[model samples]
Target chain A: MTDNMYIERSCRISENTIWLDGAPYWKGLPAASFIDFAKEAFRLLKVDYPKFYKMDNLSKLVFLAADFLLQQQDKDGIALVMANRSSSLDTDIKHQQSIQEKESFFPSPATFVYTLPNICEGELCIRHQLMTENIFLVDECFPTETIEMYAAYLLRSGKAKRVMCGWAELFQENYDAVLYLVGPNGEKEHTKKNIEDLFR
Target chain B: MVELKEELKGKIIEVLNLEDVTVGDIQDGDALFGDGLGLDSIDALELIVLLDKEYGIKLSDPKQGKAIFKSIETMAAYISENRTK
Candidate 1:
């Protein structure tokens, strides 16, 4: 039954550009930093959520990708299975720096809240009001096969009506986010090869 | 008190990362939380840390924040009264 699942849509953010469903959607400034790019993309997308401005870089990346994929679509009962390579190291370093110096030791709640990789997933859930099964994994690579298997299992087991799976990695200036929506119907089959092709 | 209010407004904007908000946007009587600036609990904690690090005022009681963080005016008044720095 899970084999019947298909890739409905995909969104990617990399190289200061945003791609939606295998097409270039937005191109940011050449020298824009990750935060700058995110803000620009958010504005270009006309996102009205004010909470978006307060998110850390990792959460912002994931939020932007999810925003592209999930906009104008039914958000109910959609599970999220995401993985990343950095595991929130970008914000972890900032939090560590905030406390490393005894003279300036002030760990902020905003920064402390995003030290875990799964916090990005939590941010997405908050933005979209998703109250379904969700998981965030940390791996050295994208773990394409694992994400496919897990998302397919969720659909086949009736755990979720739809699943959003992807990789969101951000450490320092480097950031990459690739998210795809999987459901019972779509033009592309939800196979490992098709997921890999979309990622590439 | 006017000078302190402006300073607190600037500090709040900087500490809370209110990118879309400016010092001019926040009025002296504007509510810091729901309905006005729309700051959440996390912003409240940031303001607490701001008070401690900048004004040397440690908020020992969490309930005090509800009243103290009501507006820029209230925060400045509290800081003026209790600031050890």
Candidate 2:
């Protein structure tokens, strides 16, 4: 039954470019920074969510990738299993810097809220109206095996109709995301080899 | 009063990262939260930090934010009276 799960769609964001289903979807300026790329991509996608402007960099990256992958699909009962290496280090550094100096210690709630990596998943749930199970893992690299196993379990256990799984890593100026949807219908089966190939 | 209102608007935009919103778009009487600017609780917290860092005003009670953050006009007025720096 686990083998019945298939890869419905895939989207990747890295090197200031977006790739969907193994084809280049959008490319930003070569010299643009990650923030520049995110902002430009948001405008290009015409996303109407205003909270996107306030999200930390990691959340923004995850939101963009998930938004791209989940488009035109029924979003009901979709669980999320996301992995990242940095684990919100980007915002943690900012928070640490703000509190390091006693004289200038002022940590805003906006920045403090994103210190946890899983807040990115929370943002996705809020945006997509998904009230299903979600898991966020910190790994040195993409945990393809773990994701596939967990996604299969969720699908087999009847916990979710579909599972959105992938890796979204952002530390400092470096960022990369590979998100794909898994469900009962698709041409490609959800396997370690296929997931790894899609990530690459 | 006018100068303080304008300054508060700029700081709000900068601190909240309202990239799509300009200071000119925020009216002095417009609500800062809910339907007007659509700001949420996180923006409220940022504004608290902004008041402390920039105006030397500390909000010890969270409930006070409801009145102080009602609008740019209220915020400017409160800062004018309470700001130590």
Candidate 3:
């Protein structure tokens, strides 16, 4: 049996700047509080949820995602699978700059540890305090088959009754995210396949 | 001095994106950080740049800025002392 589940809710965010090989122009987008940014992320997915702040970049994203899933899904044993291409280029650059500037320069532990693109899942799980299976993937494009494969594996394994598989793609400057919830009774109208079909 | 305070108020509003605060709202010694204008560390850095760029006074240590940046009176005093402009 597979243990993969599909998305129940989703969100996406995009900025006007091009993410060619580095971070966005910090001045391009309107200044946004962390909560406001999460709100906008959810707005892109056409979903709704509560907002809170005081988290660093990765933690903040995971916090909102877990919060959304908890409110909508009553089931436990959930998995969070996410995808991002360049990992955390923003923090990586910051770390390198610190090292290059001075002999005694110390790399920020916080920034260095979160440089992995997949750590976003662990951040979300830690926030939600979820001990379920977590996974991360890096891909060139947001492909449906990739997510569908992992999610199906989770459900069949019976390790998790539900899965929140999210596709978070960040190009040079463009970002798009889509999350799906799939489960045992997922064949119903509100299932992941149905939502994906609408997009098609 | 009053005109100087007024001019400083205008600059602060323009630079900080205070949005709703106005000259009338900011007393001469009213706190500019934390409880006053809700200015945080980032805003403090911006204000530091403002001092250097506009007044030609550079502050390498941000912690030192807390006291000197108390209000219009304090900021004006510091700028008046070190301002190359």
- Number of the predicted model whose TM-score against the real structure is largest: 2
Q: What does candidate 1's lDDT look like per residue over A1-200, in tens digits? A: 44689999999999899999999998999999998899999998786787888899999999999998887999988999999888989999999999998988889999999999999899988889999999999999889888998998899999899999999989999988999999988989998899999777
The lDDT ranking, best first, is: 2, 1, 3
Candidate 3 clash figure, as a count = 24
Over the stretch A1-200, how does candidate 3's per-residue lDDT look in tens digits? Answer: 43323344443333422121123322224565443565554454354222222233544454544554455457468777776665666557766885786644544444466567776677666556668987877776554576677677777877677777765654333444455566755433334455465233
Put down candidate 1 lDDT per residue, B32-51, tens digits, no spaces: 99999999989889998999
lDDT of 3 at A101: 61
CA lDDT, every model vs. true structure: 0.91, 0.92, 0.60
**lDDT, residue A27, candidate 2:** 99
Clashes of each: 0, 0, 24
Whole-model lDDT, candidate 1? 0.91
Candidate 3 residue-wise lDDT at A111: 49
lDDT of 3 at A155: 72
Cα lDDT over the full model 2: 0.92
Which 10-residue span in candidate 3 chain A carries the lowest summed lDDT? A17-26
Question: Largest DockQ belongs to which candidate?
Answer: 2
Pick by lDDT: which candidate is best? Answer: 2
lDDT of 2 by residue, B1-85 (tens): 9988888888889899988899899999999999999998878888998999999999999999999999998999999999999
Q: Candidate 2 — which residues are off by over 4 angstroms?
A: A1-3
